[model samples]
Target chain A: MKFMNNVYQVITVAKKEYIDALKNRVFIIFVSFLLILTFVSIIVSSFDFQAKVISYQTALAELQASHQIIQNLTAPEFYPLQLLRGTIEYIEIIGAILAIVLGYLSIAKEKGNNTLQLLFTRPISKIKLFFGKFLGNVLLLTSVSGFMFFGIYLIISLIGKTVITNIEIEKIFLSFIFSIIYLSTFFSISALLALIFKSLSNSLILSFVIWIVFVLVIPQIGDTLDPDNQVPGGLFNKIGITQKSDQLTILKDFSSYEKARDSLEQSSFTKHYERLIFALLGIKDMYNGKTINFIINDKNSDILWLVSAMILSSTLTSIIFTKKKLINK
Target chain B: MNKIFYIAKEEIKILFREKIFFTLLGVFVVMSLISSFLGFMATNTTTSIYNSSVKFLIQKGINNIPPNPMLSFGALTDFRNIIIYMFLIGALLAVVIGHRSFIRERKSGVLPILFSRPISSNTLFFGKALGIGITIFSIILSAFLIGILSSLLLPYRHLLFDDILRLIIFYIFSFFYLLFFGFVGLLFAIKTKSESLALFIPICIWVGISFVLPEIISGQNPTALLNPIAMGQVQVQNSVFFSLMQTYLQPFSIGGQYTSFALQLINNTSQTSLINVILNNLSNITTLFISIIGTSTLCIYSINKNNIGKDEIYE
Candidate 1:
């Protein structure tokens, strides 16, 4: 019965928030703005797609023709990873500002207007109220994201462009998931700040500063502070002690066919031990000085998701802070 | 004139009363100083390395075009990006200020008392917006000046008078953009009677316009300024798709190709010739136009019809 009541309270609060937000003229304008922006983006992106296709076709033809003239000429290297990384970084920076602003303002404004106290005075527990607000914000976020996706789809269909293939869809999905994780993290941070600062504007600025530190400053700091793992022989060097030793030992041991035969015929305990030692020591160094890399080839993206869950735990910590007496502060 | 000044003065005073406004200004000042110092130090180190490279090139009788003048200040090519960031910060600051400006007065039960006086609703609205706008403008200007001054006094020293003027112009536009949204925020705060909506509304607009909307419709690809051969303008770059607008956004494809007897096309770069840099600077102007006109229209309309004396507890 207690669990049901808790769930019920959370749902009721969420419903009220949703209804109130829907009735807000500001919310309506923002929704309209989102829809309009999505529409415009689609048209613009389609034009870009058409241009890319033409360029790609021309480049491919040029490459093939050049291959006939210079048989050994290799195609220029393309940096898809760099491009993907840059795009994701660019979008993340933009999204962080939006998330921080929204998250801080949502709680800060409520507190500023004293509506938060009224909302808290309800029969519901603080946890329920927190969750309800969070859920409501999530819904708003989803609506905006959905509008953007739909607009993009329409644009691709209108342009008859096949740029958004299955691979592109998957990449988009991953990027969106990463964005949501970051968004939730920002929300948690903002909520905590709102509770601590008591003013929307302060919370907004503080959250923004934190966001900048995390999104821009931290990565740069990480790069500069971490020492590069330089190899002894350098990147291109192929000198190998094991290879040299193995070659020398093999050459010395098998200098002649008769010597080799004599060595093979020796079945004594010492000969067996020697052979064992040699076999243990004789390792190939095909890659020479190349560093052994450990790649995470896990079948599941569970770790990435676990990060989001961990962030949620941090958000739960803010509830403890929220449960503290705000009026007294 | 007195009425406008009266409104502006009232607005400014109210903003001063808000603790957050002062805190933000203080923090912004500190951050500006830190970023400026760090940026200057980092750029100086890089400039020395580049100077040596220039000397080496000259010694080899290879004269490259002089480094762009604004490079010393990180304002050469990155000025566009800096402007965008400044505009975003300005808009956000305005929204936060606007969100609470009129709403706070009503929440404090002062609006009714103020309304009972000889003050008109328009004056009240104007006053509230002006106050917040002034504060936002001050913070942005101060931050830009600090950043510029720090950049100028760096060890490498390449800051020109033109750079400072350009930055000032950029800062002005930044405030203008923010003021446009600040007024809209004023409308939201007044009409919704829910400060939460005011803050959330502007954020959603910013996100939608800058990220979600742009990414969905056009991906990351910006429109090219001109065709590769510098002949004419094009809607998009032929080579790079979804790249941020930069010098490299043009099509890299050298013209001319060879075809085999079997009708297989091969890239024949042997016959390809170098082309001059062709780009259009108009797309950026178009973007500015859209943002200015769209946001201003909403602000002007909302303020014009706003019911400033409404009860505070609407939600």
Candidate 2:
């Protein structure tokens, strides 16, 4: 009975917040941007689509010129839609910012508008009030995201485009899932901020700071912790180190070493981490079974841990903020 | 000045009183600590291992290569570049500060109370601005000091002092960018009496100016922009109008060829050479000054027109 009451109260609060948000020009602009971005992504992904085709053509030409066999050159079943994966990622980033802004504003706006005091006067529980606001914003985002998706899908379908594949749809769904997780974190941060900081702006700053650390800093720090992409010795270690006979030319030969170094230099950390993680997890066997064996167990465990931690934090933040007193600013 | 000081002091006091700031600070420090430990272990282990690998490679035949210490743990060059890009992320904080100032006061009934006093509108505006500026600066400075100290004190000793300097410079640049955004945010805060308007306007501007504008300038393609991170760069383009404005504002002769190959994919490749030449020849200081002035002027206008709770306060 209590839970239902809480839910109803939250729903009521959320309805009011949602209406307020819809009338807000900023939210409208954000939704507009998302719509535009969805279309823009269609355009951007098309470029990638073109680039990949060109790259394949160039590869074919090079192989043919060199008298090498260009075998199995058929476009993979998922070929056309692969760029959609990138589009989804771009969307997730946009979604992250949106979640932070909306969530932060939803709570902070009450105080800034001098409406929080009035809100507290309503016979609703704080939990309902807090969760209601977050869910309301989430519903709004879902609507906007759904609209964008529908619009894009319609345009593509109408155009009789061959690029929309089930695989691409799957990737888009995966991206949407990830966006939910990302958005939840931002939402929790917003609630936490709204409770902790009396001023809407300061709360926003805190939310923004949280986003920076999670999205930018931690990822970098994670990569910078891995071992495979390290620089060579400090000259002292080079003194006694001997070259092994079976080493690849790229690793051993002087000219090849420069090329290797250049290749390594140009590569992104994500790529480096992927390679190392794959090898460590023994997933390299999936690509090549012999000669290289990765012995480590539970490779995906860290990802699980990260996901769990994020969920835990979000839950804890909600619990903490829900019980806190509503200050009438 | 007194009003400014009082407001700033109040801002700082509230920051300390609030759990959010402490929570965030704790989060940052803990994250930094963990990262430092991981960086140390990863860099130390990889450097030792890679040192041997490099020796083996070189002893067999490797030549004409420069050793990049940046790869001690990972090829951190891109990661480092992203970290630099993240500095611009502080713009969000500035936006929040600016958006909240008058917007919050009005929400809390503080605006009318303050106006009831003998303070001039300019002083009121300045006080709020100064309060936000000081608060932002203090938080940023603390974060910078912590980040640099952690990097230097980390066990691996892999990070160079210069790297720390780069981080500091980036922090300072971040602060300036924050101020730039802060002023703009303040303008928006003052323009709209609505609470949602204050919160959302700055974010939308950030998304538009910092994200979408660059996207448009890059010709709707991902590859066209030379360093995507340059969007965060405080430097404005060397447009003639911008240059003229900058020349009138700052004493420094700024501007140089700004053609970065990273942006090639974003621009028409053929004109890149010419663009490079033009950018090199133009004075950058002029453009930067103009943009700052434009933002500041907008803030001034917003503050001047802001008349929230006026009748209530005067009566």
The alpha-carbon deviation from the true structure for residue B154 of candidate 2, after best TM-score superposition, in angstroms, is 7.5
Name the candidate that leads on TM-score.
Answer: 2
The list of candidate 2 runs beyond 4 A from truth reads: A1-21, A48-80, A101-138, A152-160, A174-178, A192-203, A223-329, B1-49, B55-89, B97-175, B213-285, B308-315
lDDT of 2 by residue, A1-329 (tens): 98788778888877987898888666677777677776766654454345446557777888889998788575422233333433443454465567776776676666555676776677876666767876787777667666666676665656536656554454344334444554565666666766676555556666666555555444444333334333233222233333334333323434443454335432322232233333332234442222222222332443344355447756776786676666742
Q: Candidate 2 chain A, which ten residues in sequence have the lowest lDDT sum? A: A287-296
Instruction: State candidate 1's TM-score.
Output: 0.58
Which CAPRI level is candidate 2? incorrect
Residue B180 deviation, candidate 2, in Å? 1.3
Docking quality (DockQ) of candidate 1: 0.08
Provide the lDDT at A216 for model 2.
Answer: 45
The per-model lDDT (C-alpha) reads: 0.48, 0.52
In angstroms, the error of model 1 at B161 is: 3.7
TM-score of each: 0.58, 0.62
| Alpha carbon deviation, residue A244, candidate 2 (Å) | 18
